[model samples]
Target: MLIATWNVNSVKQRLEHVLRFLDEARPDVLCLQELKATDEAVPALEIEAKGYNLAVHGQKAFNGVAILSRFPLSDIRRGLPGDPEDIQSRYIEALVSAPSGRVARVASIYLPNGNPTGTDKYSYKLRWMERLAGHAAGLLRLEEPLVLAGDYNVIPDARDVSNPEAWVEDALFRPETRSAFRRLLGLGLTEAVRACDDKPGLYTFWDYQAGAWQKNKGIRIDHLLLSPQAADRLTGTEIHRHTRSWDKPSDHVPVSVTLDI
Candidate 1:
């Protein structure tokens, strides 16, 4: 099955572009982050008209996430389980039952940006990462085929960013943030893209300002992490660079991975 993740930036503003991409790409399952809409405002009917079932967890004017799938989806839950007080439209998960009867529990997450270090928001970002690690560890113990995909808002490494020095003080590249990210990945979860390609310039997001996309300056923050079972089935991984060139495009583009079980 082809499973893809994208941070659409804003679902309402980029509805047409998203629709166009869906029609063209036709992935078996699509995960979205940064929807920046509310549940009542979600374009569910429009998306359903496209012949895919939808699961959405949205907030107002900021973070949100959704999952669209052609396959049967079940056991859906909104929000991360570790923190009840943490209010952010950042997570959604569901079980996709494939034709072969294999069920893969998948989550689409948008991690905290935590810009301007030494602030409460920055501390929240680190705390969020800790929660994610706790959840990921529990999921690994389940030993089920699981995939966590989305915009992690982390630079990951010097190679993942276009300008390493420029992002040293940025929340995405801070030592604490990077270490937390690495710890999450170390929980017996495989990063699908890195498993296939280690190239330095494989980025999924660029800033809307500073001519980042125009100058091909970007960062790799979006990711697809898989459980052992899912990792074993990974066949291909790709970043749709062309999407950035589309009309009314999001600063972030889609990243997809194919799997055969």
Candidate 2:
């Protein structure tokens, strides 16, 4: 089974790209982030017409997420636990089965961008991370094939970004941010990409400004963190950088993992 994640930026603006990706990758499950549209405006009909089961948590012109499965999805979760006040539609999880009837859990996460580190936004980012860590810890107890994948909004290491100095003070690359991400991994979740290939420059996101794409200047902020059981079935991983070059492209591209379920 192939599971993939992509931050489409906005489902409305990138509907074509989303449909194109579905046709191109043909993943068994595709987790999407940054929908930036309300539930009623998600273009669900167009997507469902492509032959996939859709589960979405949406917000108006802001953070939103969804999960699309070629197979059925059950036990759908709409929000991240541990925060009653966090109304952002940034997370959605569901239980899905592979062709072999092998069940697994998957989540689409769009963590806060927390830009300019000295404000409530940054604080909220930190708190959210802690909450995510706590929730992830609890999920780990399930001992099932679980994949927590999305645009994490974190640069895990110096090797993840193009210029270490340029991003040092940015929230995504800040020490606290990276540390929080490590806490998640410390819970025994294996980062699929690094586990398969540790090479630098294998980035998933690129800034549209400053000719970032033209210069191949990018960062690897999107990720697929797999639980122990899921990690064990990981057969391969791919960074679909070509998607970033499509007309009217998003800053991010899809990253996928093939599992032996």
* Model 1 per-residue lDDT tens digits across residues 206-237: 88898899898999999999999899889999
Judging by TM-score against the true structure, name the best candidate.
2
Residue 240, candidate 2: how far off, in angstroms? 0.3
Which residue pairs come into collision in candidate 1?
A: none
lDDT of 2 by residue, 1-261 (tens): 899999999999999999999998899999999999998899999999999999999999999999999999999999999989889998999999777889989999999999879999999899999989999998899999999999999999999999999998999999999999998999999999999998888899999999999999999999999999999999999999999999989999999999888
RMSD of each: 0.9, 0.7
| TM-score of each candidate structure, all chains considered together | 0.98, 0.99
Error of 2 at 128 (Å): 0.6
Model 1: weakest 10-residue lDDT segment is 80-89
Worst 10 residues of 2 by lDDT: 95-104
